[model samples]
Structure formats: structure tokens, C-alpha cells
Target: LDAFLDAEDVLKVEGRLSRSSFPNSFKHPTVIPPGHHVTNLIIAHYHETVKHQGKGFTINEIRSDGYWICGLSRAVATHIRHCVTCRRVRRPVESQRMSDLPVERAEPTRPFTYCGMECFGPFWTKQGRKQEKRYGLLLTCFCSRAIHIEMLEDLSTDTFINGLICFIALRGAELDMNRLNVFLTEKQCDFVMNAPHASHAGGVWERQIRTVRSVLNATLLLSPDHCATMAIVNSRPLTADALDGHNRLEPLTPNHLITMKSTPALPPPGKFEREDLYGRKRWRQVQYLTEQFGSRWKREYLHSITTRQCWHSTKRNLQVGDIVM
Candidate 1:
């Protein structure tokens, strides 16, 4: 910390490295006072010199070129906070705190009593010799976090209604929607659809769709039925920490709530490989898909839902005059 005024009437650090071969500029870095206009100019110049990188890069550039500002880290942070170019490049969009859960989500009702629905896919399946496209319809129970998936032949209204009927047949008929729309006008049942361009509004079911789609993409090679995919999605745990009580016996999965069981079905008795997916035996292909789905579900999806990934804390509301990208 040796510092003194040089002959030029500028403060500079005196260094022990004077005996070393470093340039005079590095050996005796010029000291720039914090909160001064010159300090701002120098930091701004180097900040630009680094192509407007983060503070660490800016600080490194300043020191490597032999200028030392008092409280350099804080000074650089303040500068970047107000730098219009930096703000434009790195400022995060405003986000409000997550709202309180509605009664449907908060209450512990029967599985599928209060539910959300979404559709995904056109997954290719080999039916005999011809390859056919199949879609999946997902129904998520808000309260129990149980999911029921139905396979759809196409996106036609009839196909959707048929899927809904299958879901009702298995999961029961007393279903309620957050924003009800009557997909089955004849059944006098209500359904809900998010408005165009506002996918976030359908977050509950949309999230399930993403998780289910990822599992399908990874597990399906060609000919596995959507029912197998259904079992995989339904088998996911309901809570972040699925273990409970001292026993920690089995994680509480949606299957437990829906069917009072943890496992969807006993995985067929042996290790399966990628080659099994394309093997001539259909049972092996299905078993391979199940085995692949289970490993990945445990590795990825189970851990993924355990934590809130984003919008973790709230930010101030956007003001009228605020500009955002």
C-alpha cells in the first residue's frame, strides 16, 4: 500500500517490484482517486476496452494496464449500474413475486378433482409396416399433483373429446378447470384454454407437457405405445422431498395418490440397452423404453422439480417511464 505524489503532481503506488523487470507503469501503477471524474473516465475507457464485459473483466483490464482506483470493485459496480449501454445489455426483465396458490392448488382434493390439461407430440410410431404420428393429451391434477396421459390420433375436436373421455373413464368424471371451456358440450363438461400468445398463463399444465415431452423424446425409439409414456409421466414424485416419516421407505409419487402405489409396474427383470429399442421383439422394445424412462426420470426430472429454478425472489414493479428490452 505504499503511495506517494510523483513529480507530475499525481498520486501513484510505490512498489517493491521496482527491482523486477516489469514496465514502470506496472511497477508503479498510477493511483486514481475514487468518486473523481478522472476515475470514472478511466474505468469507463477500460470497461469499453474489454468490450463491456462484467466487472471482473473491467477490473482486470484496468490493473493489467497499470491504473489502480481506490475501492475499485465498488466503483466499477456503481459505474456499470448506471452505464446505459451496460444496462441495455444486461438488465433483467422485471418480475413480481409468485402469487399465492389458489384454493384448487392449495387444497388436498382427490386426484383429478381439480385439474389442468395440455397436449404434446406427433411422436412417430410404427403400426405394422407404416409409420404413424401420435399425440399425447395430458391431464394434471392440481391438488394431488397426479397426472393422466391419453394418446390422440390427431388434433381434431373428436380426437380431443375421445381422449378426454378416456381420461374421465379412468380418473373419474368430477373434474374442474381453472378457466373452464366446454370441449364436450354434449357431456356438459367445461374446459380451459390459455389465450393466444400467452403460454405462461397455462403454466401448470405447460410445465407437465415439457417434462413429459422430454421423457418421450429420450425414451421412445420408434414403436412404444403412448400408454407406456403415460405411466412414466404419472410415476413422477409429487413433492420436492418425496421421502416422509423415519422409514423413508418410498418417495410419494403421483402413482401413489392415483392408484395407491409407488411404482407404475414392476420393471421387467434385467438390464436393457439401446440395441433393445430396435430389436425385433416388441416386449423388449417396450421394456427398453421403460428402463430408459425410469433412469432419466430419476436422474433429471425428479431433481429438476425439487427446486425453484428462476424468479426465485421478487423485483420492483416496472414504472411508467421505464424502458425495457
Candidate 2:
């Protein structure tokens, strides 16, 4: 008993007797042990003492006061999880998982019929021994995993609108794509705006941004002279085959339209043939690309649906106007 007191300060001096007092809260703080004869009663007392703080705050207070019982965190969490007062005052959040992907995302559809877009970067480049800033806008096709990149000078709304117009014009001519307005109003397409701070909502475009950044970083390191697809298309001179003239990268650029237009993959062993009709082959690649897209999409969607991680069981939630504190 003497050893325990010397070892810890769970009990603090208070006149003739010692009482529970955590350091952070000087207010009437008491530590509750689970095995006490009046364990429930003591918890109820402390809960009221702290004015019904949430599980984390209450647990912190317990720790602060140097009073701990076995499973203290679990006890506080369970207590708050069931507290009617807290439940009523605080809105209960339910994990209402979305009701499956729409047909455009799940079923095979036109490449850009459903797409996700994002803008990132002010990528630094050494131009004539001076650093320059530039931003990239990425458009990811929901169904095909195809990407179109647009370089932007800034993030102004006007700049974005202009980039969109240019992208739309180029794609409109090549793919016979419909207007963005008509696609949503007449074709049942959607243009979703991801809620702020909810990055998961933009997973499609977010992943592509990460991938493009990594690839570009690596490519730049290995081949600083390499030209971007857009640069070549816009007729910038002297683009020496992006991956350093290495034969290892030939497998990724099997078609001229895709090759001349840009790159993919880490290449392979041996020489590979470039398909006839570079311009048409770019569009033709979509034929096989759709199968690969569907296969990958289905595999991922199945994995996502098979598990209920964390909040597997439902608990009784608080009612409206429940007393708190």
C-alpha cells in the first residue's frame, strides 16, 4: 500500500483525506475503477463530474488524474456509446454506404461518358537555368482508365474553362463526343463535385494524379530531354523518345497515335512492332482497353462490397432533444 502510493499519485491530498484529481481538470475530477463495489455508481458520478464529456475527453481526464483501471478506454467508450444524454444532444452518424456504382461507372460505356477531373501541381522545371512553375489538369475516364492532360498557367476559373474548351474541342473532333451540357441533360451523365475535405469522393481522379506525378517525376529524372505528349502535339521540337531511347519502353507504345501522343508501362524485352495507321490505332486501342477496364473495375468493386470493416454492428442512437451535461 505504501509502495503503491509512492509509485503513483492517483490520490491527491485534500484536507484530512485523499481524493481523485487528474492534473488537467482541477474541477471535481474522480477516477473510477471497473472492479469497485460501486463501479457503475462511481462511473456515473465521474461522468456527471466532467459534465458528460465525450469518450475521448473523459478518458483523457482519467489519464490526466493518474487514475486508471483495466480496460479504462473501453469502459469510457462503451459508457459514452450508450449514454442517452450524449446521444440525444449529439447527432448520431450512420455509415450509409452508397447504393452501388451507376451503370456508366460499372457497365462498359463510351470513354468520356463518365469522367472524373482534378488539377494539381506547380511542377518545378529548370528552364534556361531558371525555375518555372506550371500546373496540370487531369481528366480520367471512369470506364476506360484513359487520361487526358492539360497544362494550365494558373487555377483561375477562366483558365480552367479555357482548358476545358480546348480539351472538349480536340476530343469532340477525334471521338465525336457530345457537348458537356448535352451529355448531362440528355445522356443521363453526371458531373459530380467532390465535397470539400472528402478526398475519398474523388478517388478516381486522385489516383491518376498520384500516378501521373510519380511517372513524370521518374521520367524527368531519367530523361530530362523527354517531351510531354501535348508538347509534341503542339509541335515542340526535339522530343527524344520519352524513356531515354531505351528499348525497354517499347511495349507501352505499340501504336503511333498512343506512342506519338505519349506513353505508358515500363517497357519489355525485345523489339515490338508499331501498328499500322497511328491516328486510327489510338481510337482502336479502346476496343481491347474496355475489356481490361471492366475486369479491373469488377475485381475492385467486388472487394469493396465483401467486407464490413470497423462499425459492423449497429447501436441504439440518441433521440432528438435528449439532455446533455
Candidate 3:
């Protein structure tokens, strides 16, 4: 305060001409002491008045027309960061490292064992005289690259549970198949729901759905009828009883369906030659196959770990003590 009395390092302030040497808004040049609260408040007010402009604009507006404080840039940056409008609009830099493969994708399991499930559409279907909408529940396999789809009636919880039961029945014919869904309590099975806004959590299923939608859209344009288009979409050629190596075969891989150019695309990868394994006590055979799958998956996972670029590269890091929306 004593040194400011001599007007050293004095900065112009907006107040009418006054006798104070310390930054006085008294319409004359005056010095502002370091870490002064009044100057910060004034800068904050000016920053907002300028509608959250950058440091350069804020400093220029204040210095050229109003005041010039030491560390003006630092103050303006802080003020802009804390501004409500600026905070709301500012986006944080994305993380640099990609997350490791999720547990389901990394582990070897039966196709459809660990799946990402989602529902879409109330696509119109013709029935007798009236047209009605129907929904679809898609089950995307995390491993073995298989998918199982089921038609749903509505968005009700009962309908969802029923759809799940239908899927288990269709796929688990060899297991102790049961039509009796006699569950005494709702807690018999736990349900996992994805976060409402975090669509990335379900991107795997979303990609499969988008691919299917693209194909369906083009096919329907030509076929025009829902049933016929679906019939063509669902058709898959039967697998032969044996491969040349006498090894058991498996059903169609989702990769083939997702990228197929024609229906009934008869290819060896689509054949499920392991159909004969579905006899009584098929659970034992399934256990053996599951182990083999796990082993093969481990090898593939190791190889993939060495070569990854999808999630590579670092992004700008967030600033410390900075405001975020």
C-alpha cells in the first residue's frame, strides 16, 4: 500500500480522477496490489458482460477501454473458466488410453452366453385388415460371433421377460428345456440396465442393429412386403453332417450374416455341424466345448493385446482447478 502511494506500476482504473495511488476506479491511473480481491471481482464481472469471451478478448476489452491489472491473463482465464455459460459449453479432452477388452469379450464362452441386449422399432406389420407395430429384441453375442433375435409385442416388463424366455428356449433345446416359468419372486433373476445417456456402453449391440437396419431397409424397398423380406432375411442354408476333417461344425457366424451379399449365402463358416452333439446329457459335451473355446480365446486375446490402435494416442489433459460442465 505504501509503495502504491508513489504511483509505481500504476494501472488505469474506471473511477473518476481521485487521490488514491492504489488502483482506484476514480478515472485515473492507479496501481493495483497483487492478489487484490476487488480487481478479481471487477474482472469477473467484465468477463461475464463480454459473454464469456476468450482471455485475449476479455483482456483487450478491459485494458484498452477500462483497466490494466498485473497477471491480467491469469485472472481472465480463471474468470472465463468459472463462467456459467463457458463451463456449460466447454468439453473435456477425451481419455488417451483405450480400455481393455470388456470381461465378456475377453473371456471365451458359448455363443450368446454373454450378450448385450437391446430393443428397437415398432415396425408396422400387416395383419388381416389392420396394420400393427411390432418390436424386436436383439441379443448380440460377445464371443463366438453369434446372434439370436426375437420378436417382441410391447415395451412392458412382462413382454421383455417373455422374450428372454423365448430366446433361452430356442437356443437351449439340448439343455433341460422348460416351458414352466414358475418363478415365485421377481428377484429370481437379476436384471442389468445400461445408463440412460451412456449409449457407448451398448455400442456393440448398436452396431449390429444398425447393420441389420441398413440391410432390412434396402431389402424392404425391393420386396415391399414385411413377411417376405423377413423370410428372406431369416433364411440360412443347412449345415452338412460332417466337415472333411470329421470335426464337429457350428452354426452360422454373425460376421457372415452382417456382411452377407445374398440370402441363403451357403458358406462353410455358416454351417453348424455340431448339431449332433445335442443328445441327452448334452451338458457334459457343452462343458468340454466351452473349455476348448476358452483356450482358443486366450490365445487370440494374447495376440490382439500386442496389436491395438483403435484406442491409441493421447488427447489434451484437463486443467487443474478449472471449471467443467
Global lDDT of each candidate: 0.74, 0.53, 0.55
lDDT assessment of candidate 2: 0.53
* Model 1 TM-score relative to the real fold: 0.59
Model 2, position 103, has a per-residue lDDT of 58
Best by lDDT: 1
- lDDT per residue for candidate 2 within 140-242, as digits (tens), equals 6655455677777788766776767666765542221235555444434355567888776677679768767776676542123223633322232111333
Alpha-carbon RMSD of each model = 12.4, 12.0, 10.6
**Ranking 1 against 3 by lDDT, winner:** 1
lDDT of 3 by residue, 208-287 (tens): 67755665566532214433443443333222222236465443333333333222212222222345357566554544
Q: List, residue by residue over 1-325, the lDDT tens digit for candidate 1.
A: 7998889987889979889999988989998779999889999999999988989999999998999888999999998988888889889756766665677765445668788887788888778888898888888887556677888889987888788888888777767732224445545555555698777667888888888778878786323545676677777765555355786535556665566322333366887888988889977787776665455444544455445555677778888877666
Candidate 2 has a TM-score of: 0.47
Q: Which regions of candidate 1 fall more than 4 Å away from where they truly are?
A: 1-31, 64-66, 83-100, 156-158, 165-174, 177-324
Lowest summed lDDT over 10 consecutive residues: which window, candidate 2?
A: 250-259
Report the candidate with higher TM-score, 2 versus 3.
3
Q: Which residue ranges in model 2 land beyond 4 Å of their true spot?
A: 1-41, 44-78, 82-98, 173-191, 220-325
Q: Which candidate leads in TM-score?
A: 3
